[model samples]
Target: MCGIGGIWNRDQKTVDRSLLQSFTQVIAHRGPDDSGYYFDDDCGLGLGHRRLSIIDLSSAGHQPMASGDQKYWLVYNGEIYNYLELTAELVALGYQFRSHSDTEMILAAYQAWGYDCLNRFNGMFAFLLWDSSKQLLWAARDRFGVKPLYIWEQSPNFIAFASEIKQFTKLPNWKAQVNPQRCYDFLAYGMLDHTSETMFKDVWQLRGGQYLTLNSDRQDADFGKLTVKQWYSLPSNQQDLSMPEAKQQLQNLLKDSVKLRLRADVTVGSCLSGGLDSTSIVCLSDQLRQESANNIPFQTFSSCFDDLRYDERQYIKDVIAQTQVHPNFIFPNANELFEELDHLTWQQDEPFGSTSIFAQWCVFRQAGQSGVKVMLDGQGADELLAGYTKFYAALFANLFRKWHWGKLVNELITCRRYQNATEIQRMIEPLLPIWVRQPLRRLLGYASETAVPSWLNGSYLQTLGVTPQVSAKFALTTPTSIHQLSHLQITSTSVPMLLHWEDRNSMAHSVESRVPFLDYRLVEFAYSLDDTTKIRQGQTKAVLREAMRNIIPESIRTRQDKMGFVTPESQWIKHGLSDRFEIELQKAIASLGQWVQPDVLQKIFQATLDGNSGMQGVIWRVISFSRWLKVFDVKI
Candidate 1:
């Protein structure tokens, strides 16, 4: 629950304390409670931290905390929900602690178990440990990507790391240079091709489940010498799954996950949207808390909008009634969001063009004001449980291509899937070759087929430097699921944008948000489960609903809609921003040399203003890239 920043100068030069201080200060919103720094002038290493006290509110919680023997110092962000448990295990192993702080637990754990400490804990986290004895640095991101970490390295004397990329702007030479291919990927797929790359050319996000180590003596920063190891990833099963067994396993894991996430010293609540994921989270979390005799009546939070077409407060009300959990509703206005946009984008360290992000932000703000320090959310459930309609759509595509029309239609009916919206038709009508519906489809596939043979194709290594497994996953649609479920990995343009919004919006209020369903184990298991478990007999999220049968409101449990924290964005753009959209769009076109095609953007703006928020995806990508270029000063 903090922002961390630091520098390691291989040359043993003193790091400018003011610079590190300045970098971290920019993210003070992330950790307003306290700030700390650690430096070893002789070792050319330094670490700085901004704290948002949660677990241990004592002075013992002060960070840049050191191991008992003082061999290592840690500047950590995020909570180790199992710290008390890990602490007991360490004490049994003869470890001594001076504080109840998880930071101390983290430092001690690293000292005792080395990098293996990651496997023994459960929580959202991103941390860096400076091993004074070895002059090496170790950092790890959480298993579920709930917390974010960024890294930058060049053949140089310095390698910088931080919880947010804006801290890197403190670098003397850092620039906002845009990566063209990133724009292409963002436009085509909504994210830069892989996890490691960002919109910026030099900075990279530490892919979740990966850790990195840098040695002071490595002249080139020796990326080869820098280990990027994954402690967690979805497991693979060569065979399909049994629905009954799958349901039981999902139920057990989910309950355990909710219980673990609820471990907090502060008030804990759940984010309940109209969607199955969040609703289920509220039900199970409230049930688990109540059964544990914790007597902690949890609070439920939901976002509100003037547009009831997209608002689902009724659904939230339904669940609250069932659980007796008091509900909090926050209404966000586009006008207020207009003012917060720049600061919000700065916190995210990139331009986020999604308006719905504002809705999530309002919820987080309300949580902060309600005096809640930690909130449980169903962030990863969609990815893990085949909860999105896009998954159904992709499954439909794969089945029809394999000529399994009966199976496709049956699953479609069971999932309550729909088809051919006017907007979708416009994009695909001409692009989808008429012959593709039949035997001629094979030829049509060749057009969108990537031109370069990826590492997955078993060729010479690629210039992109993406790993073979990563390249293969990119080549396949997405989700890295089994053959029958592979197509479900496809992320609509709005999905990635929404996730970015989620992270930035939540962190903006100094509130720690946790997502259990995204855990690699759960994700892999969900995908490996038989598709029937996810969508059965005209019900989406069937297995999840059954697991929470008596916990969630029966009305909501029976609801078929899967809309997430949706915002009535189109109407807002039309009534609140019509002039700004056109003026800015035209200006964007005028600077085509420094920007992307204005015409492409104008149409997206018009469509959205004309009351089609779904089209906001393409426009969101373009606008994000445009703003990123202007902010970063990328010439291309």
Candidate 2:
């Protein structure tokens, strides 16, 4: 894993080495092991990298690594778990390698297969390859958006790309300016994955499963000349399979995915939350480890909280007992959440939606301190499998809308008995208008329907030319099958934001977090299966339970609650943070009047302090944005 950045001057002026070095140094936390730079003065092209040695510990793995012919150079970030396999295939094709590094495999693969090499990859990655021979640049992000890459077209003739947006700030003439539209979207609807646009105005992300190519020969700096393509997309057609067949296929695919992710040379551990997803990974990984000659205990990391509602210590202990794994726990409270707000926000590069992110931050920090370099996490499982209660409601609503009343009634009864029919109201939720739904959702502690918070300034939104409603790109859709909802959640909605948090939090501690659930094959297979296979007879992740039967602990396997890295934000606001929170909130209101109504914020603050948990979302969003504005010196 590494942090990579580069500059390609279309104007053909040599890039200043010091400027490149400075920009690369900005993300040193992403890669603390080694650093290198490559520049071609004549072509005005430069690439810099900071490496966190995982696959190869020797200098042989150093990047910006070059091809044997020196015609292509790669500054890469992320691991290709299947590199050893790809290496064998390349060697069969007469390709030679100087090192066991995946970086070398990438260079040789590109030499033999060109851009087609991307198809053969089965890992998380983002890379900028300088094709000196072709006078072009090729950039690609992994299929599932596991790794992040940000791009800024500084000028028509100059382009810069980095693993983190902070590096872009180091470039001369670059000012950290807030993108008002994204800010409006974030504050109003809590939407962050609606588009490629970032909170920073000019900087944009290279969307996952996508690639960009630039021709140095085209002297015109027109952004229009950039050719961006979606190299991979989810399978749209669902597959017809019986429960047994589906379970077998899923077991094989998921096991292979877990096996491949455990390919790193350094000690690799798992993040266990005692939840179904994390516990499943830990159990399966431990099972795999035991089968192999390596008999050492695998390390698992988790966050234990004082608040019982937010803690999963019992489940964590259950999994550890079953798997016989070493368990490490960190207790993060309101003090740590408030104390590390600024630095954590800085690491995230954008404002997170809630305090739960701090819980994850603490987990990763503990992993790094524990001398574990690579950690396996269960991030994308909820999206892939129909694990969220919201999905259950969505499936019911879709059935009712389609006049499948018999099925709907049967499922509703089952849900009430097994999973609680709490989400049944979501069946009629879409019929209500936004104005009514917004208040109703808030009253019920469900998600808010309106895009913007009630406390934001209406006039400011008008000036920004956006609305409180979610952007059309992100407007929620009611799908007929669990598979369809899974695709939408994974690609267009929730998983992207979660992936962003995982990348930033893990990288902040210089640790690599791999998600086995995101393995494309597993995601695709889950999407192809029927909704019944995923959420059957009121149980979420039913197919997963069936597949892991007798393997995962019964406590986690039978769990109905879904607390994903959860924190007690509402309680924290109501009790622990009244005094200091009011002080900071008042400062934010004073500094942020142009974007929010001070009177409304004050009311919300008072209501929250008065023990209204519904307003916690608003309080957290406002404070997070407020702190983000200050930490990044963001100009609105």
Q: Indicate which candidate wins on TM-score.
A: 2
Model 1 C-alpha lDDT per residue in residues 1-636, reported as the tens digit of each score: 888987877665688898889978878878889999998887677899998888778778897988766788899888887788999998999988888788888887887888888888787788988887777788898865667788887446777888877788778877666654554455444554255677778888777678988765434445225667878654556336576666778888887787878877788887878677888788888787778877766887888876889889888778767775878988887778647765666666665546666678789989888878788887766555566554554445555666777886676554434433542332222323445532332333211334322101213223444233333235333231223343223132322344556666777888888777755456666767765567666455778877766766787777776566677666666777667656655654554443344455566677677665346555555555555556555565
With candidate 1 superimposed using the best TM-score fit, by how many Å does residue 423's alpha carbon deviate from the native? 11
Whole-model lDDT per candidate: 0.68, 0.84
Query: How far is each candidate from the true structure, as Cα RMSD in Å?
Result: 5.6, 2.2
Q: Assess candidate 2 and give its lDDT.
A: 0.84
Q: Quote each prediction's TM-score.
A: 0.86, 0.96
* Backbone N/Cα/C clashes per model: 3, 4
Q: Where does candidate 1 clash, by residue pair?
A: 1-78, 176-632, 414-538
Positional deviation of residue 501's Cα in model 2 after best superposition, in angstroms: 0.8
